[model samples]
Target: MNASPQFRVLRSRATETHNNLREEILAALESIIFESYHNSFTIRADLEVAFAAEVQSKFAVAAHSGTMSLFLALRACDIGPGDEVITVANSDISTTGAISQCGAIPVLCDVLANDYTINTDLVERSITDKTRAIMPVDMHGHPANVKALRPLADHYNLRIVEDAALAAGACDYGLPVGAFADVTVFSFSPFKPLGSSGNGAMLVTNDEEICDKLRLLVGYGHDPLRHGVKDGYQNYTAEGYNVPLDALEAAVLSVKLPYLKEWTAKRRAIVAALQDGLAGAPARLPSFRPESAPTFRSYMICVDRQFEIYQGLRAAGIEAAFSYAPPIYQYSVYAGAFPNSNELKVTDRLAKELVNLPITPEFSDSDVEYMIETTKDLLEKT
Candidate 1:
């Protein structure tokens, strides 16, 4: 017998918080059933409060999904058609989806060779009079050099709506990822670092005007009236999305919120070990920026013969995988809907070469060692 446990990437489960998530959810249901003051919406409000406090942001808008938050953020910044939003291609289609949703064009940029983040230099040059925003994804929980993008954005009179979907609780320059951008979005999908029971997301910002618009837009434009109401239930002032955070999900996330930092610390420790084990190997580890602290939602490596290695990992009962397989622009669904200048050489190469390693907080020491050894063994054979 091998006597080693399987190392699968992204086998996420519920947070093992001492508090009962079930009870919190039931309390929310009770509020709804009993018709308490402010109704069950209090649960959603509480969750937003906890998340905002955790990230140290003045305002937080509970959203249905990370993509919806992005959509809202784009509108909050007044980015619309005929406007261009610069972003990298090596991310989920949702990164570009937000831009398209706002009737704006997503100008794809390349990424860094070492770290796999947005190539700030290329992003700077891509800016033009039509450029409205820069949406940089903190890929693999690593904060893209966002601080560098801020100065560049200021110079160009552009806005920044960060894709922080994978970077919950991540920090850069002594602050969380959401702290630096004009509006930052996060996901609480079951698999991310800080997750909810079901799908949930948030948009955090310090700007009151953006905050007001986000709240209204998520609720079908109720706050700032732009039009009229339907029936007697839902209303809308401006044409907006019905992307509210459900009460049950909010309750579940609220219970799990307190333990996020501890969980993040555990994940960071595992990443440190992986870095040590893979030192001077054929593979390249995470390309973390200086003074930035990222929660390891997942670990990635740049290696050769990516598919062969992926097959080897799968054959060994490892659940290793890669992302975007098509790097957004190349996705069959988009199929030339977005424009690219072939400057994404790094992004294109990484899409084919990078692999995500199993390194969740759920992983055990044995799991970590097994993955390290398995990877080394596979590399040797390759």
Candidate 2:
């Protein structure tokens, strides 16, 4: 009998993306280094324009990271101390941390068991007089039902600062994930769907006034029309931080940007295969509403043996893990911090059962099959 052939390692990492785009990245960098004599701001400005158009937004400002983008978004909305921002607990610390950093309270909200996004129905009850904004996260590239919450937000006069860190290519309500938001932020971290070489984010908004505020905050609080005309004197608009996106990352991202739609389609195809392959498996797969067209940052499933399956996948050279588990409120830093933590029943349950499977555009059919077979085997036995 012939021996069985060994398959390639099934892992999702930014290195794979960078490796695939290495030549393009290098060429982009070379052009920036030798061909152009402009400052970092010039390339960054170009990226901002291109990215804004890609997402169908009127204006965009690239920032150092998604965290910075969120902070800037809230700041642009004038969120401050004693204000409250309603958001989900089953997300990266960045979601709530941005609100907290702005001296605003992060009011915890439960997520839906199916899509693992905020439960819009519960949002109104959480609203209080102090609430200034609603920051809904598109968890695991699943679009939060922001459209449903739009009326509630409008009624309360609250700003919608969407945290779409992992949802770079996802869409909802017949538009991009950020279309319904006052300000939407997309992350370009190494592990994100639209992975860049390093950390970067873009804040997009239709409101020019909000765009102006975001630019003022990212650009050292300098209003070009108001200050620095005298050459020696520079006036500040608002106390802001210098957190603009790096020019090199912008250049790399620009090369990758045009391919986003194609890449997103690839991600969706892989997930469809996984869903079909795992239909009989013990794990409960994620489900989205009909209108939501989510791009896979990572495919998540709820399983009883979360750790066992996670460890098994790792031992078998498949990268699987629990992301955003333990809920943010359960973190040591947030212990006793959120009074409403106990109300996040669904979020609490998801933290225990959710397992993220590696999904990337670089994944071949064999990689997808191996992962599916390995996970099903693990689920069957464990």
Candidate 3:
């Protein structure tokens, strides 16, 4: 069966945006080829400046991916083996993997049913003497309850790392997503709100000491200058990993950053349209908190008959997805890694019911209407 005309039209618009960016990317590559001398540090510095301006932070460190950004942030804060980090269960497995890579245990907490963000109450209850930090993931562009979570962290003397990968342009209570946490990480993968042509991620913090340590950690533990130390010259510091973001990705991100707000606004508008259209449908729309403005990274709806609906949407030639199905806790790798794995009730429920629909600046009003109508029809039949 052919895709709905509305679906085809919007998909074509997305393709056009991608193709235009590809052309710009090729032009950038040609310019780089012609340059007599390319200094990577100079490019990094420029990106740092651009990121600081965008997020209103003192320092921003670019890395190869968001996973590395999280690892670097945790390492900077001195979290490692024998420590536990409290985080949401309904998140990408990369969050858990990053914690594991640091040799820290990830204590998964259930999310709020409405927003799918970490339940601050569960986060507090999960804390232990071994707990080192609280990493709150801003799922699908909605900022977590940072104000409430920050106080909880302070009470426990724990650091906070905001996983702002899906929330580049989102803000909570007028503050940017990166503003409140001790350290915040943002991903610029092709699907993110502020994406580049390829993969990139960044860490931002107001603490100069943490920023300094992160710079060394992401740069293979070597001091930038390689200056003299007690024994002739010693530049290497802590044990670290090489996770620098490439120059090309940085350039592309710089180009895309300026349009992030506009793109995010368009996404939010689409979400509103979807909500209006699905008012009488069986699907449960995600609740928007007035205090925080979501950037709508992925427009998700929870519905009964999730699997059937997912298959139905695909059969109808619409591109829909199950975001984070088989919650991180259900992964084989996490089978017995932690003790309280089965406590994620809400996470389990969401994993079984959530469905993400097409959400992009390229999606048109008619496209959203078709999805809404198709979904209602599918649900009625089931």
Q: Against the true structure, whose TM-score is highest?
A: 2
Q: How close is every model to the real structure, measured as TM-score? A: 0.90, 0.94, 0.92
User: Which 10-residue window of candidate 3 scores lowest in summed lDDT?
Assistant: 6-15
* Model 1 clash number: 2
Backbone clash numbers for all candidates listed: 2, 0, 0
Write the number of the candidate with greater TM-score, choosing between 1 and 2.
2
Q: Taking the tens digit of each residue's C-alpha lDDT, what string does model 2 give over 95-157?
A: 889999999999998889999999999999999899889999999899999999899999999
Give the TM-score (vs. native) of candidate 1: 0.90
lDDT of 1 by residue, 147-243 (tens): 8898988888888999999999789999888777999999988777888777989999999989888988898778533434456555555767689
| lDDT winner | 2
State the lDDT of candidate 3 residue by residue for 14-72, as single tens digits.
34565767776566555555663364556666887888788899988898889889988
Clashes in candidate 3: how many?
0
RMSD (Å) of each candidate, 1 decimal: 3.9, 3.9, 3.2
What is the C-alpha local distance difference test score of each model?
0.81, 0.87, 0.81
